[model samples]
Target chain A: MNIIEVRNLCYAYEDDEPALDNVSLDIAAGKTTAVLGGNGAGKSTLFLNLNGVLTPKSGTMFFEGCQVTYGKKEMLELRRKIGIVFQDPDDQLFSASVTKDISFGLMKLGLTREDIQERVDRVVRQTGIGDLVSKPTHALSFGQKKRVAIAGVLVMQPSVIILDEPTAGLDPQGVSEILHLLQEIKDSMGITVIISTHEIDLVPLYCDDVIVLDKGRVVFSGTPAQLFAEPALLRAHNLRLPRINHLMNILHNKDHLAVDTSASTISTARASIKNLVSAKENI
Target chain B: MSGIDKYAYQSKLARVNAGTKLLFTLASMAVCLSFSSVLVSTLTIAVMSAATLILGGCRLRCYIRLLMIPFAFLVTGTITIIVGRISQPTQALVSIPLLGARYGVSADSLKTGVIIFLRAFGAVTCLYFFSLNTPMNSLLSLLRRKTPGLFVELMELCYRFIFVVWEEAGKIHTAQASRLGYDGFMRSLHSMGDLVTNVFLRVFRRVDRVTAALESRGFEGNFELLAEQEESSRLLEGLAIAATMFLIIIGLLERLLT
Candidate 1:
């Protein structure tokens, strides 16, 4: 079932220029979806729309089969179901203390003190920030602050969590750690995880589905395999195929090697190469 | 400011109830300011310093350094009060003719300046003790419970964004420095101007993003503050109240004696 579905959604910061134009997409429940776009490509606008942070000019957002209303009570209910972790951790984490920041959303939900504490504790453990609960937010490294930002949203127990460029400023290892954590969240809690990023390389590694946005329009919405299969289309949108997929395409198109061009990761490329070698050997 | 913040989080008294610390600090400040006796002000300073150093676990060196910041101002302020205009030579303890006017230090003026200086310094010490022991989050939590909603919300936002703006300014300064932007005096001035402009723009952008993020978390008009840990202890609360009353009584007694 689709947890969130946006139809004909259009938004504009200025009157003449639209940030999102006639965009439609579905985020499946209990799945990881990656929104792919370059800067100013309306990825953030789409995420904001999904979370009801931006009201679209001419579209309807359906949450669990009901059209989202902009009324105070309805918006609050929508926001409780869809939590957003912004691109900047500094912007998202407003509290001085880690535990306090993580409990902000839960407190807004009007949970009991004990309930909020339990949720904060659980999120701290889950996010591997056990040592940082009492630490001031300003003392944390960028990666640690990012984890706190994620934990802040997670503690609210949203059914659909939207992250804007979750690994934008993270180191290589930090990137993988965040992706692995997101995977764990999807598996354990059955959450609908949606992240918008320009990191094509990370999509195939962690995401089950992909939505490609270009110039405020949805150019492609399908599995990563389907998206990567059309490299020309991705290039038209100012994106490239994942690195491994590009190398595989080179082997297939230039070297005349019988390898899967859809291989988007090193492990997949390795398996495809092994298959090619065995096939040649059998011949 | 950052140093005090760091020490505050690491203070041994950080987990104590903020209300108790606030009550003690404010009451001590009030007593120090009200009493005209030097002994009362001296005792107030000593008690606050001891609390900060012993109970709060603030290093002696750090406390002295923090004290020095206000001492410079106090000395200049007191100097103005001590230097008086004397109409007669007999009234002047030490007189100097400056621009055809007699500027002198009288005994009465000297005594008044000393008392004022000590009182101001003692009040500062009381504030330092409270700030060094209680984290800003705890203070904000307390304020959220007591103050008007709008006032508390403004304070919360300001306190949270100050660090953000500081970090952003630091990043911009470093970026400029790496490019030889501060290699010369003129270049340094130019870079500083550019840095301020860029930081302002970035801060404005961040404010928009932060507002959207808050809305995403269901923040309506009010900022939802987190529930702080209940740190109230009957013994500690009673001791704090008693100490404040004791200080007030001392101030009263010292006034009577004088």
Candidate 2:
């Protein structure tokens, strides 16, 4: 069953232009979905709508088969269910200390002190930020701050987690650490994960399903392999296919070679290259 | 360096509670203020300088430098004495003219001026040590704990708003820098006014956003002690309190006897 369903959502800013127009999609339960698009492609707008931070002008959001309407009462419930990790850690972690920021969401839910403590401890431990508990938010490194922001959301134990550009503005080590923690959360906890990002290479590695958005519309929604197969469609949307897919497209269309063009990652591309060489020898 | 950043190669005073240090600082100032004699004020400076140096983990040199701030009054007072009363009492055998007037030198006013300088220096040193030892947030937290509920809430809101103002200032500075606002004096003056106006609007918008964020996070506008009880630190704090009291008592008794 679809854990989240959006039907014909439309949103505009100040009557100037549409930010999201007639966009509809479904997110599967306990699966990872990567919403991929170029800049100003309404991916973040869709995320804001999912979290109810922005209300749609003409569409409905359904969480677990129940339609969500924007009201103070419903927003509270929606906030509890949908955890949003903002692109910038500074926006999310405005608290003075790490401990306070981590427990902010849980505190809002009005959980018992013991429950709050337990959740905070668990998330902090999982995020590997136990040593940063006493440190001020400003004193921490960029990676540490990002982890604290994620811990803040994780402590809430939201049913569906939406992270907008989680890996942006991180060093190599910081990016790897975040990706590892994200994999651990999805695999171990089985929470529905929806990440809106422009990292196409990471999308193929981490996401089970890929949603391509363009100009405030859902242009394509399918598996990464299926989407990568259509290079023309990707370019038409002003988005490039993954590097490996780009190479495979060159081999298939230019070289007139019969080879599988579905590989979306570097390692798989190398293997496909080896297979193509062997297939040529057989021919 | 982190171990003794405030004082040169001394133990840390960062662990001490802000409220306790403030109260002891108040007591030091009160003792110093109640006296008029040079000997008593000198003793007051000695005791505070030592306490701040040892217990507050501040350097003696640093406190002395901070004490120099009150010298503006000292400079004015000294000139007043030299012109208004004394003329070369120690250096000159004859009167000197100031503003086309001759003034007589007095020995008693010289002693009074010395006494005034000492008293001012001692009070300023006490305040300096208090600020150096206690962290800013802890000091604010101490204020929040001691003040009335409504006032504490107002102060806390003010502290939170300071960050909002800082962000606004940062953006304004950036915009001005990009526009070459610092090239000329007139532009700089105009930029300052523009910065202030920008800060006001940013702060206005920030208040609504911050309040919403706080409400969403269930901040009921109260300070609860989230820290666990530190038994050893509490004992040390108590000892520090007693030691300050001891210094004030000994100074008072010595002055009375002398």
* Tens digit per residue, CA lDDT, model 1, A39-74: 989988888888787889998888998988898888
Overall local distance difference test of candidate 2? 0.72
Worst 10 residues of 2 chain B by lDDT: B1-10
- Tens-place lDDT per residue, model 2, B1-258, is 132222421335654666666776777677667676576567667766676777666666666666566667677776576435444446433466677655654556656667677777767666756766664445545665567767755554554445546765987799798989977999999998988888888767666555444433334555342232111367546755675676567667877798
Per model, how much of the real contact set is kept?
Answer: 0.70, 0.03
Model 2 clash number: 0
TM-scores of all predicted structures: 0.89, 0.81
Candidate 2 lDDT over residue span A1-283, tens digit each: 7999999999987786898989999999888999988899998778877877778899988999999988777887777778877776655666554675676656556567777778878898999998887555655777898898888878778888888889999998998899988888889988789998877888788898989988899999988888887778988988778877777878888997776688778788888888879888998
The complex in candidate 1 yields a DockQ of 0.55
Runs with alpha carbons beyond 4 Å of true place in candidate 1: A108-110, A275-283, B30-35, B83-109, B176-194, B233-258
For each candidate, report its DockQ versus the true two-chain complex: 0.55, 0.20
Superposed by TM-score, candidate 1 places the C-alpha of residue A275 at a distance from the truth, in angstroms, of 4.1
TM-scores of the first chain across all predictions? Answer: 0.97, 0.93
Candidate No. with top TM-score: 1
Show where candidate 2 strays beyond 4 Å: A112-115, A256-259, A276-283, B1-11, B36-108, B144-181, B187-232
